[model samples]
Target chain A: MSSIHEITLMLNGDPVEAAVAAHTLLVDFLRDSHALRGVKRSCDMQVCGACTVLVDGRPVSSCTMLAVDADGASVVTIEGLGGPDGLDPVQEAFLEHGALQCGFCTPGFILATKALLATNPSPSREEIVHHLSGNICRCTGYQKIIEAVESLAR
Target chain B: MLPRPFTYHRPTSLDEAVTLMARHVDDVSPYAGGTELLLAMKMHFADYEHLVDLKRISELRAVKRNGGTLSIGALATHAAIAADAAIQGSLPALAGLCGSIANARVRAAGTIGGNLCFAEPRADPPVLLAALDAQLCLISARGERHVAASQFITGALETVRAPDEILLRIDIPLTARSTRYERVVHGHRTVAGAAAVIAQDAHAAPRVWLGCVATHPVALPNAEAHVAANPGVLDNALTQAIASDIARLDIADDEDASADYRRHLATTVAIRAITATVEQEERA
Candidate 1:
């Protein structure tokens, strides 16, 4: 007997309300219901950061988070990071660094990077490595990803 | 993989949370960040008929030091705990331990109470918290009681907390002369972890508590007595003896590593942690 919940959250700077199941995961809720596919569900488990999204400005694994838990919170997906002007600095950096090989893990890494930079604008290389350890990328060897963030730090 | 359907109840206060849990005692799980709970449910390792969401409870978001003890609210996220100035000032090792849990996303989502309640053998907080003589406040519709961190974790993935009870807060005495949590690695849950808290007084020898080398974190009365007896201890043999003694408990093995390897790693970590604080204690 699953129950439906009316969750009103600020999605990507806009107040979006939806009716979701009690067991609806945030990733699926965003992707399936809201048609926000930027949150890649690579690792359903929290270990892989493919489903990373900013909840209340803090990066949270949407796959592990319940949709109801995010009610009334502000959530930022990869799609939300983009402005009318152009790509976000993180996306541009990834593109400039050729950080993505398959691009599957790009959204997670980009979101994590965005959160990291927002909090610690001048994170050291060690800091960047330490903070982003949760997101796993299978391609590009992560050297370019680190460099991408490093470039932002500089 | 999405978890099986479970009714969700978001309670804004501790009383409401506990009562909701008590109403569905056998089937309700108090949800925090849902980092571990959802993962377990998705893996088909757990199923709950109801989940009492505790995240909205503001009382459980405390991270402060009051009356000589660092009182950490159960709902405080790992990232908050790690970044807390009070925790850093009093128990940097605990802060460091919290900071290194899983990853950035988990640190942002997971809470200290949830981590300790899970009681995974490969856990980090219990190891350090137990060593630091932390106390946990448990609340239920029945009543409330404080349990020592050392006694909270009875076994792997098992805790003394009743299904109807919710862990409200964690209180750790900020008393160690110098504390150090030495891990085998970072960016991963520790296969083996050693946390050492040293308190040296003119009235008595240094008191030491050891954790993560056994099924549960334990007081090294045997090893402490040995170290106290030999105040200027500089022998490798004694360290080996202490290590073996600490590893006397049953250390189980899973895919992470073999029992022997786990014990061996535990011994190494314990010895290193002990030696580190002991040296600091002696210097001070």
Candidate 2:
């Protein structure tokens, strides 16, 4: 029988308690269990960064991570990045730079940018491209995404 | 897609984790980061009845330097290694290689030990680690043993690690060297990875290692001999020697590239790595 794990995580700023199957993915736990539609599931494989989320402030592919792995750790999805008063600075930068086309890859890009800016606020264009290599966008071709991240870097 | 259902075991200590793995034996897998193993499980390529998660064991999450050797915990994330002060100060080439892995998320989620244990030929760590002459510490209920990096990986997706053993850490000799890693990738996966390490001492012989194009990391002895024989020189004869050197290896065939193309790439990549390392050494 599959074991049922009772896990507690700091989701965003709040504590969330869940009883999940040991194999439940962090992406599924957030989308199906918590209704956070912002975490998209594009490539179930670990390649695509659409399922990216920050566990304890480290960006990881939620599709590749077990929900139980984050037990007792802090997880921040795109929805959690928004402030009570307004959108996150990364979201604002994306908007100002028109960084979205289909909008499917925006959350992942935003979260990745948030992680990048958090650690390196003034990354060069090459550094930005290197850091964002995990994310893929068919519509934008990443020009505006680069601009968005570059603007934030400035 | 969700991975196949399995009982999860989160052991807070390495001893307990080893005991659990030993009890389950062939039916169990030591889960760390879950990037590669989970992918195989989800794709139905491999499966396990029990997964022993080792994240809670904090002892294996450190980077320490004692004497002439530097020890990096098995659980150290690629991103952690890339940003680690010790690694950056001692082996910037390795730090750069770690930074240039699959992507940001993978770097954040993947562990050095997990990478070596998985023994993915296309992965980046093993080749450079092998060139650096790193050693992996394997521990279990039967005590512990340290295996040289070159011997740790036996083949593609295979290692010398026993079912009951858990890789504890990776230790690298702490000596300054002119090192460079070169790789070509398509989409999200690597096509080829090659590395060159020249000891800081001008007369110290250099070593070359290549990956992804082979079932295991291939060290080129003829190429190293060529470089050592002709210091501060790169020419057609050197290229010919490198080509002949890697031609002896048994390269692998994947959908991305054929064995022939990989062999060709091996020559170019090895030359590129050696040339870059030599230039950097001269500049330094």
Candidate 3:
């Protein structure tokens, strides 16, 4: 096996470095090495958006990204989407709209919504559906999730 | 599933990146966002011994517009393209296509060059680029070359991109013609496939490109020629030939969809796309 490589990046407002295998996924590095388990690993593929995170203020599936590729980039996990003390409006909207059942896909959904609403403050309903089309949630059937994003748009 | 172990090299300069790729050749995989490549690697679909990370190469991340053409750096993400005012003003079809790609997360990380270079049959950009007649610029230690979008892709998951070459920029020429895109995505199921139709009424004939059809993006030349030749007979003949050609096309069908259904969807989407393009042109 190839030797591990050291990568440095800004993680949720903190500068962190880790020696990860060249092929180590960003989600695994976050969950295991950095201990920021808020970014869940579900399908471990790009199909399911459970592992989404913000790379330079844009949401991306971390499972589909290598840790070393994130060098000098800024990443924001679900934990970075504000906390119990002060929640982001998107997260609050998700809560208000009951967007989660088991909550396995909540983090990805919240972060994806954050990225969307950031660029488009008041997107139409069709725009919401189009923007969130890539994310799959078996538990919620996507109605509440759409509602959550819609509520935020309003 | 994790990707196979490989050495990582993050080059800050495009020249250095090109040199690294030229040196490594087939062993090095140049990754932009890794949205598709990393997933394919995890699925064991691809194996490379080295990865030349292009995210650190700042030169490849710019989007500039000159007189008559827009030069978009290969590393510019889909989100960047979709939000770019120049793209929105000049090529609204491209902007709409960018916004309509997978989703926000995928758009954020996915680069236009990466998506085009990956050459996935279901990707949205190839069909739009083909209709737009976009030019793909490739660079390597040897030299640089430009290939039209239609010639860039040879087959499914295949491109003319040499192993030693790096995609530099995509040049889109400005034309007076209007363009539009329409796609029918099966939204009920998890793996429901999509059929996208791109049409541009530029010169005499309206060029149409169909996605999710054949191994690569398929151009409807016969239909386009018919429309161009007989500008007055715009209704049944054009639709019939195009639909028939689409039905006879040989495309891969997995368990999620059937060849017949894809053909039907392709014809329907193509017709809709053409109708939309014509309607927009008439209004303009």
Candidate 4:
């Protein structure tokens, strides 16, 4: 095998560079290298959406993407969604509707909703369910989350 | 956990990527959206010394229409396909499948080519592509070639793509046939164990592709022929034939489901999908 390489890309609205092992996952790079621990890693497999982030404005499971594959691409983590002063609409809706319980899966779900609503501001109930089906939440049942998103549509 | 150490190269062009793959042979693997490839690497199921990242290749990200057919770039993410109104209009089934794939987050990053090339029996797009007779464009250091979806998958986690080849695009022929998809999942608790059926009724023999019941997506020729020969007798003969055939397939083992259960689900889902397709055609 060859040695690890250094790569640079726009991350969370900032141009960042990091030297990582060729096999390093984007999730690890965000959490460890760049210290953007806002993107949590749950299952680490593509099955769970806890590691969801936007790659060029599209929500993608960061755990399934290689750090090198993200080179030259624009990425947005949960931190980029909002800051200490305020929150994105989806985040606010999540909080207002009590869509989270453990909050482990909140970031992934919020990002997924953000991506969905960006293109579809008025998604039907079925559309909301289908869109968020990939992000599994073990707590607080998806009813409240769906309610929150539905409320947002209103 | 992170994947084993390896060298990564981002090729700016398809030609460069193919050349890198040709030079490295089996030691090199292509990384598209890396949804499946990266996960496989993390699980230690693939041990390649070098990864040729195709993200930098601009040509592979296009979603264009050539004449009546829709040519979706291999690198086009599921989100892109779902959001494209052209795909939604020309291939509604394809768009619906893209929208329903895994989740919004995964779909945002996962590519259609990656899904098909992964050769997972349960993957969504392959079944729909096979039923629609989608053409896969392959490129390599040598040249380009086109293969039908049914001919692309050789077996479980396997494909006809050579070591030096990259799947360039998926060309879906524009047709007036109405299509429908039915997926039977045990309620989304686990990742595996889902049966999907895609069918088109306008052709002489309505095409049906069954997923999650075999090593690769299976085209139900017997059921299709049964429907074509006796369109009136579809309910009984088609269902029986598909059920028996699915019962006999050798599906890969997974934690989410057993071989027998997947077979049963496949037959059940195929019946529903076939009926739904017929009803949809009637409504149209």
Per TM-score, the best of the predicted structures is: 2
- Whole-model lDDT per candidate: 0.82, 0.88, 0.80, 0.78
| lDDT (10s digit) by residue, model 4, range B1-284 | 77788888878877788889898887888788777887888889987888888877888989999996889999998978987999998877778778777767667778899888888766877877887788999988789999998789888799999887889999987764667677765544222222223334335457777875667777777777776676535566677888766666667657777777767777777777777766666676
Model 3: residues >4 Å from true position, as ranges? A83-86, A150-154, B187-205
Clash list (residue pairs), candidate 2 = none
Of 1 and 4, the candidate ahead on lDDT is 1
Chain A only TM-scores, each candidate in turn: 0.95, 0.96, 0.92, 0.92
Predicted model with the maximum lDDT: 2
CAPRI band of model 2?
high
Q: Which pairs clash inside model 4?
A: none
DockQ of every predicted complex = 0.85, 0.83, 0.66, 0.69
Error of 3 at B257 (Å): 2.1
TM-score of each: 0.95, 0.96, 0.91, 0.90
lDDT tens digits, residue span B1-284, model 2? 66889999999988789889999997988898888999988887888999999988999899998888889999998999999998898889889888888888988888999999999878889999999889889988889998999888889899999987899999998664788899888777788889999886767778888888878887888888988898778999889888887778877677889888888887888889999988987898
Worst 10 residues of 2 chain B by lDDT: B198-207
Error of 4 at B50 (Å): 1.4
Task: List, residue by residue over B1-284, the lDDT tens digit for candidate 1.
Answer: 77888888988878778779989997988888777888899888999999888888888998877877889999898999889998888888888888888999999999988988877666778878877778999999879999998789887688999999899999987777877888775346576777766654534544455545456666666666666676547577657666667666777766667778877776777677778887886788
Which one wins on DockQ? 1
Error of 4 at B271 (Å): 1.6
